[model samples]
Target: MSEHQRAMLNHIREVNQHIENLVTDYWKAYSGIDTWQFWLNAVLLIIPLVFLLIYIDRRRVFQILFFGYTIHVLMNYLDITAVLKGLMYHPYSLLPMPQSHLTLDASLIPVAFMLTYQLGYNRRINQYLLAVVIGAVMSFIFGPIVHAIGFLKMYHWMSYWVLFIGDIIEYIIAYWLTSFFFHFYRNDEPTS
Candidate 1:
């Protein structure tokens, strides 16, 4: 092989070795099953899921499930992006993924929004208002608790307000997308 090719290969190998070391250090520090944080994250991921299974409205099961799924997908996407961009980090994680706080992004946040959507949809209350309230609780209350407990770390210019706004926007996008689909299926024409 050419000398330039050999140099490039050496660089790639060094980078991979560094990544491997990081993974090893991460597992040693955070992945222990005996740790309280791990157990807490595990419960956070599982309890809401069990509750959703037991209490989800059967009458509008499809709509609620789809909406929650959309929220979960977008939340994970945005979370991974934020982590990659160095906006925040989760010190403890239940899974070994690039994005930490899997429980919150994958389950709790989505389930909370799902229940709020159901409440609004069934009771004829304004979903947007309910979402804003949820966002406030998540931002002003839950976020601080999580940070204080050492589960989350915010860096750079990121703060609870960013989470607050992002949570609201995520809910709105998921609600609109799910509603659009419901309308399309029922009326065969898209609604505004």
Candidate 2:
């Protein structure tokens, strides 16, 4: 690599290391087990998973799990992008990963979407409508509540409406992908 390129790479690495260190410090000071924020984050991460384990449809376990996994992946990507762009951030979290608030990105939101998808599948309800409703609840209600308690903070024109729209879009994408894959899977099954 050229000298300038190497210098830029070094600077980026330094910044990344600094960010990791800051995240660890913040977690230790405010997000550890002694704080209520930590407990809340822990609960947010655990309860939804428990519900999913207990209530997930056994007949369609793989399909439901795949759908939820898609949601988790999409949200993690969005979370990293938003944090990197300074659009939003989690001040406290169960994990020291600077790009995501693990409770919401990996647990609560994905599990919520999974259960919602399961409900729609079982009832043959409209998923688009479910997406919108769930999006609103997560973006407006849960987001604000988390913000109010200092877990999340929005910045740089990132409003609740923006989050609402993003949530709906991601949900639609995940739903479409999951349905498309399972449709083909069903079609390819051997006839009795």
Candidate 3:
């Protein structure tokens, strides 16, 4: 391999290790289960994901999936930092980390929302507006629903608005990032 490749690999490894260390330390004080909860969290996270993949589709699949995955990575990493720093809180975990197994916060539902925006509108402005709408719904509606369930709980100077802010940030980042990739990926073709 080239010198540049080797250096890049080393940098990536360093960054990954840093992330793992951060995640580990952040959950050090939190209660985690070794048996039933592990399976429960894993099942909760994976079930929705499986359903989403089975239902969503086609020429736009990659755009949605790729963007969601990118958002997932960024959201999870940031969430790890945020929780450690007291910016957010959750009451469950699938692993001994800051993220849940189903990763619902970072996956499936948000991706489904993105798919809706992507399919329902062809304009970027429209998508942004839609994201705002969805953010509102999440803050005003879904927030209470999940909070009502033990699946989610809030603490330490946080509110539904904070949840909405996270949604807006996630959607905005995902939209633009996905758009850039889609533009290049579909550049050779013409859209009507």
Ranking by TM-score: 2, 1, 3
Better of 1 and 2 by TM-score: 2
CA-only RMSD, every prediction: 3.9, 1.1, 7.0
What is candidate 1's lDDT per residue for 1-192, written digit by digit as tens?
Answer: 999999999999998688657755785687657678888999999999998888889999999999999998988888878888999988788875546568898888888889989999999999899879999999999999999999889999999999999999999999999999998778975679
Q: Give the whole-model CA lDDT for all candidates, comma-separated.
A: 0.87, 0.90, 0.67
lDDT ranking, best first: 2, 1, 3
Per-model TM against the reference = 0.87, 0.96, 0.67
- TM-score of candidate 1 versus the correct structure, residues matched by position: 0.87
Q: lDDT by residue for model 2 over 1-192, one digit each (tens)?
A: 999999999999999999889888888898888899889888899999998999999999999999999999998898889988999988988877676588998889999899989999999999999999899999999989989988888898999999999999989999999999999999999999
Q: List candidate 1 stretches off by more than 4 Å.
A: 1-17, 188-192
Q: Where is model 1 poorest over a 10-residue stretch in terms of lDDT?
A: 19-28
Best by TM-score: 2
Could you tell me the lDDT of residue 190 within candidate 2?
Answer: 100
